[model samples]
Target: MGGFFGAALKRDCVEDVFFGTDYHSHLGTRRGGMAFYSPENGFQRGIHSIENSPFRTKFEKELAGMSGNIGIGCISDTDPQPILLRSKLGRIAVCNIGIINNAEELCNEFYDSRLASFETMTSSKVNSSAIIGALIAQKDSFAEGIRYAQERVEGTMSLLILTEDGIIAARDKFGRLPIVIGESEDGYCVSFESFAFQKLGYKTRRELLPAEIVRITADKIEVLGEGNPDALRICTFLWTYYGYPNSVYEGVTVETMRTRNGEIMAEYDIQNGTLPDVDYVCGVPDSGVPHAIGYANRSGIPFARPFIKYTPTWPRSFMPQSQEMRNKVAKMKLIPVHELIEGKKLLFVDDSIVRGTQMRETVEFLYENGAKEVHMRSACPPIMFGCKYLNFSRSTSELDLIARRIIHEYEGEEGVKYIREYSDSKTERGKRLRDEICRRLKLTSLEFQFLDGTVKAVGLPECKLCTYCWSGKQD
Candidate 1:
């Protein structure tokens, strides 16, 4: 839900950090921040709300004044960070990406009742990044503090700490997220997305192992600590949806994997004789387009864009303060072509259907434009469970998901026991589930990619990928 970039370069690195952090705008839309340390300026830090504007526009004015050879920046969906803190380790700036589900538990155990206190947000909840900083300061050294913080935080934690001399980068304990290093002629860099650095003339160095902690300076990267490599469980959803088209994680490119996923879906549909006879194969805008392209390529169907999203002025559809405003913005962004929809049978491939509200509205819009038929395909399997390892906002509660809501409608609370069966397309429950969704959304047809197919599309062993949102497997 958030991403970070850090630079320890030979020259004043503010410009590189600015552009590098801007590249991660696709990963988050809430807050943007940067922290730098110069002997002349000390730690120059800036944080701003980017809810209504792009990260670049919000930070452009300050970029010219802030100068430092060592700096870090972040695009976050949660609390403002690269927050400055003073502790036993000295004055430092800290920023983190990932959730801390057990913040209260950790505070109760370690935080001194009378002496220790936290800065709270409007909701009175301590900012997760600040909590992480507090936890890290509790230890004697950066390496030990990072290890302690990773162990104590129940959810996920991948962070960057800005020091006067260098930056400390730590990957998630289970490698659920990513921390990659890049090499340039001047120095080195660290980023969540590899492409962020590649564009800035930084060559791929190496990705940090699970729980790997390293100190990155202008000349070299020093390894501080590392956990077991076999504990890798990278989030598989990145390839299907959240990750940028150009981003690569664990040797797999997001766009390529998505295309492969679509091809696999088409292959299975043809074998089952479920491939719809449509005039064109289309995709929901943005992330869904690649999957649709692959489907079209494999099914021998022509790919067409029936509608285009107008994004020059509009922010992300989900950026609005309220759900009603967000839904309206989503529809407002689409400029439909009547010729593509009128009297045509169209099949659409969407990255994945989580809540189903937008997809339902999309189907209705097509029919209103005189679509003869509309069939839908989800590139990934049904999300049977909400994610637990990160600060993911797509589905907060189990009931927030449409699939879970439907299961409850039919079988009540006991439906929880058969979640696996409901996700299985060949099962009776799964068939009923699809039929019900179609009836509600008024779709001519609907099919979700199977679990095995998703894994195959990623080209990674199932054990290495985290399909927790679909399979609900903790390990």
Candidate 2:
């Protein structure tokens, strides 16, 4: 979903904050903001709509006029943030990264108690950061307020608060997201991505524990609270899809995991004697490229770039509001090589098949360019439920997922009971589900990575990971 970066430096920290936050640009597409605190100028903050432009281009000119040594910034998919608030906790600027399922209820509770009211956004929705700030303000100290907010929110929340002294960083209660600290001679930095601070000449200090809270300054890092190690449930999709290639979380790099996952998938196919007869193996561009390389290396197949993403004009496809528009942009970005696709049996690896609409369109595009047969391999299992911990998808209903829709068609209301069976490709229900998806998308064949294979690829114990989207088991 979203990412944040904060720096507490002995010298001017604006430059570090600017670039550190820019490193997280790929995480969110809606709003970008930065707030700085200095004794000379007080808190100087800027928020911009990055729906059309990148973070650097939008904030470059404004950086020259602003300066501070302690700051916090974020790239948000939800509300505009780095919301400045003056409460009993003092003048602190806060930015949040997480969803709040009980936002409306919380807002009503505040309203009924006459404690506070929130500023609404374009959709008349209360800004989550503001609500969080109010919740934090209810307590006596920053640590207490943070714990109070963490205890009340149903969904995940990891935040950074900027004060005159330094910045306070808090990871989510369940460790659903990550917050890492980096150290340098000048000061300390906190970020959602480890690589963000690494690029700023800072060494990796350590990642904050689940539900841990810390206060950072130019000289020292003080732990305000410790998290529960046994309650960790980090989102597994971060490695499979959302995380940046250079970034590492839970000691696992995203690109490395993807490559391993692809290798595992290929190994399974080879063992089962189901390796496809294909002229070339290709990825779905960008994120899927590394996975395909691993597959090619394992299977002794040639990896080719049959199509390249034309990002000169349309940098991000998700920036568009409507699904139809997004789909159009996605098609327009792919510049296919007819020489490779013409009269060739091509196998493609994608991160995951969500709604299947875009994958179907991509397959049709290949056929239009004279592809003989197209086989699809999904790097992860089919998503059976919507993500509750993060704002990963825009689907409002479970039926919005293609797998759920198919399950509904096959078994009506009773199909929900067989989600595990449908996820297991070896089972009869799973085989039928795969066949229907392939038939609908006009693909020659389809295969998805197994849950065990995915866990093995991640190099983590199954109990430590969150597989709710695939298994619907929150605990």
Candidate 3:
């Protein structure tokens, strides 16, 4: 849901940190922050709200006055971060990328023990970065403190800590997110997205293992603690939606995985004789394009762009807080091509259908534009649970998901027992769910990628992947 970039260089690294952090603008829309440490100026930090503007536009002026060889920056979807703190471990700036599910409990524990007190934000919520800082300061050393925090946190926590010596980069305990290191002649850099540093003349050095902690200096890196390589359960949504197309994680490129996933979906449709007779195969745009391309290639259907995204003025559709505003923005970004949609039988592939509101509107828009029959395909299995580890969805309750809502309506509270069956398209419950969704969305037909198919598309061991959102299985 968020991303971070850090740099330790022999020379001034302000520009590197600025552009590097800007590359992660797609990760978060709420906040952007940067903190740099210099011998003369100590730590110069700046945090800005990016809800109304882009990260680059908000931080451009501050970059001119900031200069440091060691620095860290982040794009946060929640609380403002790169929080500067003074602790027993000395002054350090911290930024984290994961949610703390048990934050209230931890805060209560801190209050009960008289260990720490938190400052409330405008929304009356505690700043997670401050809590993380307090947690890190509990132990005698930074390394021990980080480990303690990781062990105590219930959910994911991958972080970057900037100290006077250098920067400390730690991947989450379960490796739900990615933290990669890159090398260059001037120094080394760390980033959540691999492509961020590659543009700055840095080659792939290595990725931090799950729970691994490493310190980065200008010319060297020291391993503070090793990670449990066997305990990886990286979130599968990265390749499906969150990750940049050019980025590679665990040696798998996002675009490559998406294309393969589409191919697999197409192959399945063909084998089952479910391939529809359509004039064109189209994607929802942006993230959905690659999947549609693969499907078109595998099925020998021409890939067409029925609607183009106009991004020059509008931000991401999901960036807004209000559902109504988001829907409006989503509609404004898509400019329909009448030539492609008029009297055409089109099949549309989307990354995934969450609440299905936008998708329903999209199908209706196609029909209004003279689409003859609109068939829909989901690139992944139905999302059965709202993600607990990442801020991928804005839905706060399980009922916010269309699949969960449908299940509830069918079997009331007892449908939970048949979740696995419902995920299988061959099962009666799954078939009913699909038909219900199709009727509601006014689609001619709908099909979702099988769970096993998605796993195969990622090309990772099933044990090493997190399929909690689809399967509701956490191991």
In terms of TM-score, how similar is model 3 to the real structure?
Answer: 0.99
- Sorting all predicted structures by TM-score, with the top scorer first, yields 3, 2, 1
TM-score versus the correct structure, for each prediction:
0.98, 0.99, 0.99
1-475: candidate 2 lDDT, tens digit per residue: 7899999999999999999999998899888999999898999999999988898898999998888989999999988989999998799899999899999999999999999977788799998989999999999999999999999998989999998898999999989899999999999999999999887899999999899999999999999998788888899999988889877988999999999999999999999998999999999977888888889999999999888889977777788878999999999888899999999999999999999988898999999999999999999999999999898789999998999999999999999999999999899999999999999999999999998988999998889899999999887
Candidate 2: worst-modelled 10 consecutive residues by lDDT: 312-321
Tens digits of per-residue lDDT, candidate 3, 328-383, equal 88988889999999999999999999999999999998999999999999999999
Q: What is the lDDT of residue 113 in candidate 1?
A: 58
Candidate 3 residue runs with Cα over 4 Å from true position: none
Name the regions of candidate 1 deviating beyond 4 angstroms.
110-115
For candidate 1, the per-residue lDDT at 67 reads: 93
Local distance difference test values of all predictions, in order: 0.91, 0.92, 0.93
Q: Which ten residues in a row have the lowest lDDT in candidate 1?
A: 107-116
RMSD values, in order shown: 1.1, 0.8, 0.7
